[model samples]
Target: MASLAALLREAGHQVSGSDEGVYPPMSHFLADRGIPVQQGYHPRNLDPVPDLVVIGNALSRGNPEIEWVLNRRIPYTSFPEALKRFFLRGKVPVVVAGTHGKTTTTSMLSWGMEVAGLRPDFLIGGIAENFRSSYGKGGGDHFVVEGDEYDSAFFDKGPKFLHYLPYLAVIGNLEYDHADIYPDLESIKLQFRRLVHLIPTEGFLAVGGESPAALEACAGSLCARETFGLDPGCDWNADGIEMTEGRTCFDVTYRGKAFGRFRMQVVGHYNIRNALAATAVLHRLGVSARDIGRGLESFAGVRRRLQLRAEVGGIRIYEDFAHHPTAVSGTLETVRAAFRPERVWAVYEPRSATSRRNVFQLEIADALAKADCVAIPALFRPDKVPEGERLDLDRLVADLGRRGVAAWNLETVDAIIEKVVAEARPGDLVVLLSNGGFGGIYDKLPAALAGRTETTPGG
Candidate 1:
C-alpha cells in the first residue's frame, strides 16, 4: 500500500488512506511521500473521496469507509484491478508465483533486473531491503511482480494473480495453504492452473522440480515450461550448494551448459532454491548470470523474513512473518543452517485466519518442534473462530512436550516475554514468528529481555 502511495505521489496524484493502526516503516514511508493517513476508519473519510477507491482485501463489508462508498455509489476497484488497468497492462510483466518464496524470489529477480540495467517496474508483498520499498517503477521495459494467490478483494473472490496477465510466470513451488478460502490442495491447485492457462504460448513458465503440486498445477498447460531446483532432472539445477557464515553459495547449470556460480548474503538452503528460481527467470529474460550473481550477492533480504530486530548481551533476536506450517519449518531450517547457536528459542503466534483454526494444529505443533524451546501466545481474538474450530493451546503444548521439546503457552505478550527472559541464556538465538505484528512482540521482547539482564541494551 505504501508503494502504491509512493507511486501515485511520484505521478503527482493526491493520495490519502485510513487504517486501524498504521505504524512504521509504512507510516514513515507514507509521510515521506506527503500522503495523509486517517487513523481509524470513519465514514467521513469517503466524503471528499477523489478519483477511485482501491479497496484492500482486508477491508470487508462492514468497514465504515467501504459502507459509505457503497451508500454514496462511489467508483471503486480492487488494488489488483487498479494495477492491471493503470500500471501493469502493456508492460512486460514477469510474475513470480507460488505458495511460498514469492517475496524473496521476486526481490531477487527485480534486483537482478535493476543491476542488469533493466530497471523494471516491480511490486512485491514485503519491503525489499535492496529497494527499501514494496513497489518500484523503473525506466525499463520489463516489470517484475510478486504474484500472490490471496483473493484480490471481498467481492472479487478470485486469486490475486489471475489479473496480472503475466507474460512470464515462475512457479517457485506449491503447497496447500490459506485453509479459509481454499478447501483442499486441489482447490489451491486450480488457482495455479488458472494462472498457468493465462500465460501466452510465447511466455515462459519456470517451475520447481520434484514438486508434485507444481507438476499437477502445470499439467496440460500450453505455455512453454522450464523446470528449476535441486532435482537432477530439472532443466535448471543447483549443484555444490554450501552455506557459510549465514550465506549461501551454489552453482546453477541450465541444460548441459554452465549457467554460472552464484552466492547470496541471505541464509537458507531454501534461499538457494529461491535464487535458482530468480536466476532462471532473469536468464530467460536476457539477464546475464554475472549480473544475477552481483544482484544476489548484494541483496540484504526482505523486510519480515529473518529480520534482525536487535541483539543484546551476545543474544541475537529475529522477527519473521512465518505463519504457515511449511514457512515456519523452512524458516527454522534456514535459521538452524545459518546460525549455529547454543540454544534456539522459537515464539509463535497463531494469528492468521488459518492458524487460529484447529485444521493446522498438528502441522503447527510438528513445525514448532524443530526449535529447542517453543512458545505459543494465546490466540489473538479467539472468539473470531467458532468454539470448536479455534486452536487448542493445551494440545499443542502437550504434543511438543511429547516430542521432548520445551513448550510454553502464554496468554499475553508480557507473559511470553517473562517466560523467554527466564529460559533464554546467553548465546541463544531467539526467533519470534507471526504474520501480523504479534502485538509488536518483536519490539517488546528486546525491551523485556534487556531489562531482565545485567547487560547492554540491544537485540
Candidate 2:
C-alpha cells in the first residue's frame, strides 16, 4: 500500500493514510516521500474528506475511517481497482500471480525490462533492493505488477489479480494458501483459472510446469501458453544447475533447444523457477537472451526473501518471509545447500492467518524437520483463532522429535532469542521465518547474540 501511495503521490495526488501500526522501511519510505501518516484510524482522519478513499483489504466495515466513508457515501475503491483505473489502463500489464515467488519474479521481470532499455513501470509487493523501492514509473509500454490472489477488500470478495487486465500473466506456482479466505486448494485454483481467462488472445500465459494445479488452472486459455520449470518436459526449462558461493548458474532450454546459460545471485530451486518464469516473460516481450542474462546477473533480489540481517559471533542470522509449507521447505533447503557443513536453525513464527490455523500443521512440521534444530514461537494473535482451529505447537514439536529433529516450542521472542544465542555456534546459520514482524526478533536477536558473545569464554 505504501508503494501505491508513493505512485499516487508521484502522479500528483494529495494522499494521506491511517493505520493501527506503521513501521519502517514503509514508514520511512512514506516519510521520505513527504507523506504524512496518521498513527491510527479515526473518523476525524477523514474530516477533510479526500476525493477518493483507497481501502486496503486489511480494513473492514467497522474501521472508523471506513465507517466515515460509508456514512458519508464518499467515493471509495479497493487498491486493485484504484491501480487499474489510475495506472494500469492502456498499458501492457504484466501481472505476476502465484502462491510463491510473485514479488521476486515481478522484481526480476521489471528489472529485466528496465535493463533492456524498456524503462517499464512496475509496482511490486516487496521492496526491490535493486530499485530501492517497490514502485517505478517508466516511459515503456509495459507495467509489471505483483498480482495477489488474496481478496481485494471487504466489499470486493474477488481476488485482487482479477482486477488487473493482464496482457501477459505469469503464474509462478499454485498451492492452498490464504486459509482465512480460501477453503481449499480447489477454491484457490478457481481464482487462478479466472485470472487465466482474463488474458487476451494476443497475450501470453506462462505457468510453472511442476505444479499440476497451475497447469490445470491454465486449461482452456485462449492466449498463448508456455510452461517453465526445472523439469525437462517444460517448454522453457533450466538444467545443469550449480550453486556456489551464494550464486546459482544454470542453462536454459527453450522448446528443446539451448536458449542460453544464465546466472542469478539468488539461491534455491524455487528461485531458479522464478527466474525461469521471468526469463520466459522477457523472451516473449522480445528481450534478447544477452540482456536477460545480464539482468538476471545484476539483480540484487527483494528484501526479506532470504536476506542476511546480521553476523554475530561468526553466526549468520537471516530473515525470510516464508510462512507457507512450500516456502518454508524451499528456503531451508536453499540455506542447507548453500551453506553446507553449517547447522541451519529454523526459527518460525506462525503469524499469518493461514499459518495460525491447523490447516498446514503437518506440512509445516515436515518442512521444519529438514533443519538441524527448529524453534517455534507462540502464534501471533492466537486469540483470533478458535481454540480448536489454532495450530498445536506441542504436537508439532513432538512430530519433529519423532523425525529425529531437535525442536522447541518457545512461547515468546525473548525465549527463542535466548535459546538461539546459547545454542548457536560459530558458522551456524539462523533463518528466521515469518510473514509479519516476529516481535521485531530480527533486531532483538542480533543484539542479544552480540551481548552474549561479550561475556562468553572467548572474552
Candidate 3:
C-alpha cells in the first residue's frame, strides 16, 4: 500500500490514507511525499469523497470509512483493481507467484528486465534492495508484479492475482498457505487454477517441476506450459549447483542446449531454485544467457531475506521473512549450508495468519529445531485466530527441546535478544525470522548486540 501511495504521488495523484496503526517508515514515507495520512479511520475520513474509495483487503464491512462509503453510495474498488486499471492493463504483466520466493523471484525478474534495457515498471511486495522501493514507473510495455494468492478487498473474495491480467506467469513453487482463507491444499490449488485459467493459450506458464501444487495448478491451463527445476524432466534445469559465502554458481540447461553458467551474489540452494525459475521466464522472453548471468550478478536481492543486520564480536546478526514452516526450514538449511556458524540462533514470531494458527505447529517446531538454539517470541495478536485454532507455543517449545534444540519461549523481542546474546559466541549466526516488523528487531538486535559486547571485558 505504501508503494502504491508513493507511485501515485509520483504520478501527481492526490493520495490520502487512514490506517488504524500508522507507523513508520510508511508514515514517514507518506509525509516525505507531501501526502496527508490520517491516522485511525472514521466516517469523516471520507468527507472529501474525492474519488473511489480504495479498500484494502484488511479492511472489512465494519470499518467506519467503508461503512460511510457504502452508506453514501460512493464509488469503491480494491487495491488490485486500482492497480490493474491504472497501471497493468495492456502491459506485458509478468507475474511471479508461489508460496515462497515470490518477492525474490519478482525482484530478480524486474532487475533482469531493467538490465536487459526493458526498463519495466514493477510492483513488488518487499522493497528490492537494488531499486530501494517496491514500485516504479516504466517506459516499456512490461510491468513485473509480485502476484499473491491472498484475497483482494473484503468486497472481492477472489485472489488478488485475478485482477492483474497476467500475460506471462511464473509459478516458482506452491504449498498450503493463508490458512485463514484456504480450508485445505486443494482450496489453495483452486485459486491457482483460477489464476492460470486467465492466461492466454498463446502465453506461457513457467512452473516449478518440483512443487506438486504448482504442477497441479498448471495441469489443465491452456497456456504454453514449461517446467523448471532440478528434476530431469524439466524444460530448464540447474546443473552443477554450488553455494559459497557471498556467491553462487550454476549451469542452466534447456532442451539439451547449455544456456550458460550463471553466478548470483545471493547464497542458498533455494535461491538457486529461484534463479532457475527466473531463468525460465527470461529465456522465454529471449534474454540471452550472457545477459541473464550479468543480471543475476548485478542483483542486490530483496530486503528481509538473509539481510545482514550487524556483526558484533564476530557474531553475525541476520534477519529474514521466514514465518511459514517450509520457508523457515529452507532458510535454516540455506544458512547452515552457507555460514556453517559454530552456533545458529533462530528467533521467530508466529505472526502470520497461518503461523498463528495450529495448522503447522509441529512442522514449525521441527524447522526451528534445525538451529542450535531456538527462541520463539510470544505470538502476536493471537486473538485474531479463534482460541481453538491458536498455536500452542508451549507444546511447540517442548517438541523442539525433545529434538535436542535448546528452545525458549520468550514474551518479547527484548527478552529474546537478551537470551540469545547471553549464549551467542564468536562465529555464531543469529537469525531473526518474522513476516512483520517484530517491533523493528532487526535494527534493535544489532544495537543491543553491539552494546553488550562493548560492556564485556576484553582486557
Best TM-score goes to which candidate? 2
By TM-score, how accurate is candidate 2?
0.98
Which scores better on TM-score, 1 or 3? 3
Clashing pairs in 2: none
RMSD of every candidate to native, in Å, equals 2.1, 1.0, 1.2
lDDT by residue for model 2 (173-285), tens: 88999888888999999999989988999999899999999999999799999999989999999989999647999999999999999998988999889999999999998
Arranged by lDDT with the best first, the candidates are 2, 3, 1
Which runs of model 3 end up more than 4 angstroms from their true locations? none
lDDT of 1 by residue, 247-336 (tens): 788888898678888888888867888888888888888887788889999998999889889887678999988988889998887788
Q: lDDT of each structure?
A: 0.86, 0.92, 0.88
How many clashes in each structure? Answer: 3, 0, 0
lDDT of 2: 0.92
Residue range with the least summed lDDT across 10 consecutive positions in model 3: 44-53
Q: Can you list the residue pairs that collide in candidate 1?
A: 310-459, 311-459, 312-459
Tens digit per residue, CA lDDT, model 3, 1-459: 888778778888988888878888888878998888888988777767768778899988788888888888998898899899888987989889999999999999899988888899999999899989888787788989999999998989888998999889998888999999999999988888888999998888899999988999889889788898888678888879888778888888897688888899998878888888888888889888889899999999889989888888899988999999989999999888888899888988899999999999788887898898998888899878999999999999999888899999898888988887788889899888999989778888788888888889981
Specify the highest-lDDT model's number.
2
How does residue 98 of candidate 1 score in lDDT? 90
Q: Which pairs of residues collide in candidate 3?
A: none
